[model samples]
Target: MTTFDGLPPLRDVIQTHGLVAKKSLGQNFLLDLNLTSKIARLAGDLTKCDVLEVGPGPGGLTRGLLAEGARKVLAVEKDSRAMGPLSEISDVYPGRLEVINADALDINPLEQLTAPVRIVSNLPYNVGTELLIRWLTPPTWPPYWASLTLMFQREVANRIVAKPGNKTYGRLAILSQWRTTPRLVLELPPEAFSPPPKVHSAVVHFEALEKPRFEADAKVLERIVAAGFNQRRKMLRASLKGVKPEIEDDLRAAGIKPTDRAEQVSLEGWCALAREIAKT
Candidate 1:
């Protein structure tokens, strides 16, 4: 069996290499190169920059990245079984794709990657949210990556781009909206993946902002938001009590009602509240 491209079909490659999808690694191998290509194109002009792909199982998306004229692709795959197939892609692309057999979480792109990079991956389910948070809230502004085109469980995707008042809106919505403009580009059904995960999946594209949407201490905002949403059922007055001695005063100064819930506050409101908390 051959794929749309000249290479052997991904299913054949998987069988040949005995690359069974491992539940522990959160692997649901994407077997369709065409679908992968669509995801690659969603990242915009890949020719201008390098791409960092996580969990490149059998290199389907890896091949898509390289095929779409990405200057280079640094694909990190923890599954040792994929080395052979990924090596085949490396061989064909020759220096265009570098397969690093390591954990994506441990790789700091700032130290290891070049400028004008884009992170594109069908991220392993187990670590997808963790990795996205890292990318969303980098220590430095104007992160190394030019953009992030990632696939996440639809529920997580909704939360990341969810706006105030949306049921899915929560910490992820606030955190993601603060620093990046995220858009849901594509929604893929479960059948799109080989193992067919129980839930649907979607691709989200995030454009990194030159600066945060508003001004506030990063740590203060993080702490304040965590507390505000700590017991979401509780109103701000109760939830934020421990954040300051005069929590109600802080809320009033920020123009937020003490009775309001976290989901009711806008990004500007959160930043304002963070500044008020800092006054204590």
Candidate 2:
């Protein structure tokens, strides 16, 4: 079937280019144009938005973003095999889609793209979580991108938007929820991709907030969250021992009981703990 963007079908593109998914690179190409369009719409209005799409194997989602009215899309792919197919997309879109041959992990979009930007990608599994943390851990508030619409294995998706008391809640939960509002937009079976993965995948949208829930040093907050949840099963008094010497005093100052586990602490409590730890 012809796609809305008038490009060749994805399977044909893959076959023509011998673009088999790479296991070591965590590549799984989503050939379904309908689903890609669905993810594009979840980023809200994109008419004026410049999108940063990582791992666009065969340009399926890259086409979707353009079809959904994105002003421009910078498609970053590590593999050189896609250069031909993505080039076809750029010719059709005419300056709307720019293909960058590089590692998404090493490129910082904040320095590359203009404002009103959104990052949308069906991230390669190997680097997906690490990329999310990088986006979430920007040095300053009101990060460059307006939002992040990403796909990941369902397990990691659950951890991103997980609530404080949920079993999935941990450092990811605190880091994600503290800085942005993340919600699951769509869930797909493992069979959704060209070479289906072993587990299911889901798309999540994280809208950037103007500020975190409270003021705390980004590095300090990250350290505190990591330490608190490092031994989540242990009480705060024990788990946070290595983070700061006065663990009990920090917990008390945060209005939290030393016996509380990491999962039981709220965002507010974590911020307070961060501040307390900074009280040197």
Candidate 3:
């Protein structure tokens, strides 16, 4: 029944510490403990796993992760204002929680935690997509964490789970689905936050595959996907001009139509195209 090991309610913690959400930091405090707990639960059983959290405004989600039985919680917060509030949680959990007063972008939280880790966070809006992409394209396969449970602007959630031929489908869908199975788990209206964002938000879960769904150099695949979607309305033969002229033969060999647009190409199709381009 204790909240965050014994730290006070997030609101009181924030006020007592004079912590205000700074627009420059892309902070929108989630004060609803119930909602934060919901996000922690969405990460499945954390009894034995380490958890990494980013932009933990007032430690709402951080507390939930620890309370849900995470063996350890490494919280990276860029805002100096939240340190005092988070310190309270650290004292409550003692050795169970570690708070880093650093920007999520600068630190590799995964490397700092033990294996069998799950990254669960209500990410800062400005850096959410960039962070997700970094995790998805880690130099090695089976990157540090087992899965990612992240909150994003609802539009971004759509992109992560978008399928080929859907309007929402594009580079993000192509890249994400190529390496992980992403699913939308929950949605929150703007009202969920102390200062509501203009747009709705959603939590998307990504379970990284041992190997990619298809084979191709990650770099090459990224290039091809970016080129294809850069001019999405154009035909593949036209959109992929940067991929060498001989790419058409490979496309045909892979059973992809040269006239197809980027939106019409599946993740598998993109992999096939990248493999073809890699040969040249």
The Cα local distance difference test for each model comes to: 0.90, 0.90, 0.88
On the 0 to 100 scale, the lDDT of residue 123 in model 3 is 96
Query: Worst 10-residue stretch by lDDT in candidate 3?
Result: 1-10
Model 1, 190: alpha-carbon shift in Å? Answer: 0.9
Per-residue lDDT over 155-239 for candidate 2, one digit per residue giving the tens place of the 0 to 100 score: 9999988887999998888888888999998999988897999999999999999988787888988997898788989998998
1-280 in candidate 3: lDDT tens per residue?
A: 3464566787787889988888888888899888899999999999999999999988999989988999999989988888888888888788988889998888766557998999999999999999999989898998888999999999999999998879999988877888889999999999999789999999999998999999988999998888888998899888887777776787897679999988988888888877877876
Off by over 4 Å in 2: none
Each candidate: RMSD: 1.2, 1.1, 1.5
Query: Model 3, residue 245: what's the lDDT?
Result: 72
Give the poorly placed runs of model 3, Cα more than 4 Å off: 1-5
Task: Please give the lDDT score at residue 32 for candidate 1.
Answer: 82
**By the lDDT metric, which is better: model 1 or model 3?**
1
Comparing candidate 1 with candidate 3, which one achieves the higher TM-score? 1
Clashes of each: 0, 0, 0
- Pairs with steric clashes in candidate 1: none
